[model samples]
Target: MRTSPPEPLAAALVEGRTSSLKEPLLRDGRLLWLEQRPQEQGRTTLMLRPAGGDTAVELTPSPHNLRSRVHEYGGGVYAVGGNDLVFVDDSDRCLWHLNLPGAPRRLTTPGPRAFADGLIDGPRRRWLGVMEAEGRDQLVAVPLAGGEPQRLHQPADFCGYAALSPDGRQLAWVEWQQPFMPWQRSQLWLAAVKQDGALEGARPVAGARPVAVAGSGPNATDAETDTYTDTSAISVFQPLWISPTELVVASDASGWWNLQRLDTASGAWQPLLPLEAEFAMPQWVYGMRTTAWDGQQLIAAAAREGAWQLGRVHLTPDRVGTPAAWEPLEQPFDDLAGLSAEAGTLVALASNPTSLEGLLELDLTTGSWRHSPAAPCPLQPEAISQPEPLWFAGHGGVRTHAWFYPPAGGAHAEAPLLVKGHSGPTAMARRGLSLGIQFWTSRGWSVVDVNYGGSTGFGRAYRERLDGQWGVVDVADCAAAAQALVAAGKASAARIAIEGGSAGGFTALAALCFTDVFRAGASRYGVTDPSALASESHRFEARYLDGLIGPWPEARATYEARSPLAHADQIRCPVVFFQGLDDQVVPPEQTERMAAALEANGIPVEVHRFAGEGHGFRSGSVRIQVLEATEAFFRRHFQR
Candidate 1:
């Protein structure tokens, strides 16, 4: 029997006229969100859908770019209260105020400062948020009527997720110091709000506490041990004030990020609806919400077994410590975020295997929902390849997860495999519809999105699999995923290739150097030198290597051993690199050096550098070019 060749999907169908939706907010029956327009040079604009209206309208016009750069990968850019909207303008990194039916006004003076994760304090007539300036982060208050910003608190090196009590008497927020990412360790803080809007008696109420230790340093004698303390390892996320004295937060002390109620008076942490599922995600950006209170029940999003679902917990305040009733809502989406609930309404950014990300609105009373898609998907349902969850034996013979996407039409005999390592090294490869994956599958390619050991959506123990073993663990898992497909007769062993961006790029390069499964690879702004990343990376990840690869100078040998550039000669197949010249995270120099090393070893290597781009490619033209070039390179090298 003979089969016809599959049709190739055009690159324009994947990149053109596509918008990314984020940060959905529901206020007074109104829906607001941020839409990143790729056709508009990746400018994110504010969008609003009026109450009882079907059509949504754009609020911030061109050149506004409603965004924040507080931690570079900014989230929590805009906040709304009644008729007032406060946002951090990307152009000037200043806070801007917008009153309904009026022009936007600049509230903060222009400087190096940037604000995010803000909320309007109606009672005080101020906007309170985390401000980043001169590499220092502090909780600040800026007058809504326009004035100099006031510093409210600087409890740690970073702070965000500020929530003012309903009575406006107390405030709660999450903060963390260096050497650890927010997901690894963070503190939940509580403070009294003074009449003058200053914080009084602020202290940590939840999260890991660092206790002093003697002789904790590597190579330290007894004399130097007492000065060192182990870094905190518990993470607390999104403190929401249900009342003036009671609040709920997600803490990972139970090995999973679960809901916990913190009583302000006694500083007691009470477990709420204890479950094995995760109720929080990594705080890579600000303004992330997974749980919300809608005046009656607690609406939450939980990740279980690599997929996300919406659930509600009925709280019984009188019966303390009584397990709440957990009801999982039947929804179409598997990936959810930006959850906001108020006045019997719930809004979130959601997507499933057949849908692109969109603003999802649910009526708590009726249990009905509506979706506003970010963009019209170009491909038909039949052309989209759905992800089939696969559990394979990975490094150390432990079970690892991946999503397998066969050819669009159906499974193809001996199809070429494209293994993808998702960025973050801490991020998950969700079961969502991705046009990019469809682009290849439509051309008869099999794709596997590997959720390697360190990827989230799993428990904390699974996420720590890459601790001090970033390159080794990620590389092994990706190779094992591809090999699993080969063993199952789903992919051709000789034609498998791998690709990734940022941290995932590191995984791809490391796989190429250390494993024999992948014949070619593509890396976008990938890290080739762990030592360089440790010393020259930004402040947010300055101490990231302390956990991923061990403390900097102390583990210099391990860094050199794991670097792909140092082992580029071992890569026998062709490789292509895409890098943004202005990328601050993984600089272009790293790509240049790796390409040079591969070229010297007589390996076919191509380096494509884009200007006016940052860590990620935002321009549609660049995105199209990257896809075309990568496809061409893979086709030319894949063994038939």
Candidate 2:
């Protein structure tokens, strides 16, 4: 094959970017997923690929945004039971039921209540999910025939990832109280499904005391209980039912987020795979699938060292010890998401640094894999920069990993390096070809997407490196990665710039303030003041800083000492802050304060607050605008 020539990446290419295929749902020989259309101003619609079909059908029409803003980073926007569908509308937060024969009918009333992580239970004739109402989160059951939703389980500070048993008589969900993020510590509960679909006799499988059902249990005055088990050490997630009596979960009690099974009968826990890699990720959004079970076999996505790979485990009567006994499935992609399996067919959203992302289907029996609606790379192969997996010593000799993308054609011998930190502070940098990163690398800038301390993929030992050291560890790791790149002659030390969104944005601000490694920085709604984030953040992340930094009031001094806003006088570099006015995660005022502080200090500062956008930029126009503005700002301060 003849090699194509290299070319510079254009903003139009970024504006036309379309490769994110999200929320793959497989049922009754049909596969449906979401595709974001940049040309449509970042409008997302549902696309269906029928079983054995080559083309996909756009199920959702125009002006209908099938998205949920429940937890901010929305997911579980739609659920399918055969042909019946229940989805949350982003515009009105209403649940709409679609039968595919006519227009979608509104099922739930419009109110302050937002529903997400939807699961359809055809046997019970109800839709199950996590509901947030009046500042409380709980598991709710909505009748398919359309009426007021019933609060099924007890209210907690936050609740999500409600999964139904195969028999539909039992429900399992995860809940965490204040001051502890889901990743920090959460309890897994299994509740008995009442005759009317109300949850009863709820008990913690891995945490606190058995929950009382209102007037039915030991402490009964009403129909629900508010006092929950105080399990502030063990974190659990992905409570999937492998069998009617047994539930599989990924718990971090054993250090890593490993796969384990909880017997609903004896409540005994069984360790399936005690490996170091994580089988479950931090619950940033709804409906994040890490493992899929088909009653006989299991397909799981596991992460190690920042890369994700899929594995297959056959369920047998003699199912035993370590992950060594399980079968390892070979795949072309390094990043796997949304793993769903049924009837020997497994589907996942897979991608790599060189491949465009799409819905990948695998035939377990034949080991045949295929991707639907394949997106071919518009740019020539040479124009794209493949990321080189990098690991370096960061803060206290901790091993930190990052993906380094060199500039195309090696044009700049000492290229301006852009260190990008991922959000989640708890989330890992995905191993895939992100056009946003390519946009920088193709424009003669080296990019490093850092999976610093506190990031997932690495075991709990490495992840906890940020405990009570959030601002310190993340900033050190980013600066260390940049300095290591400069030491390797890959990046110009004086021209290094740092950029991030959300928690990552906090790292960028901290790097610019506390360190001299970066000359310029861009924060996309970054946390400038930890105190503001702890007090003013949403219910989901209100107490996140407790573990990220420390608990409030008691750790008030620590938060102030670590916050970038407190030390803005030391940051002399030009910084650009891009924030959404509607961002509830890190309030827009956080970014505005940082910008004002920089400007007050006579340091160059630019702040862009976008309307109609949340924590993350979804609109194409704003994305393009932020990209262009950041590039221009970086070029202006590249230290020629």
Q: Which predicted model would earn the best TM-score?
A: 1
Tens digit of per-residue lDDT, candidate 2, span 401-470? 9998888766344688999998888888887778788888877788999989988888888788988899
Question: Model 1, stretches more than 4 Å misplaced?
Answer: 1-6, 211-232
Pairing residues by index, what is the TM-score of model 1? Answer: 0.95
Per-model TM values vs. the true structure: 0.95, 0.94
In model 2, the runs with Cα more than 4 Å from the true position are: 1-5, 209-232, 316-324, 411-413
Backbone clashes, candidate 2 = 1
The TM-score of candidate 2 is 0.94
Q: Candidate 2: lDDT over CA atoms?
A: 0.81
User: What lDDT would each prediction earn against the true structure?
Assistant: 0.86, 0.81
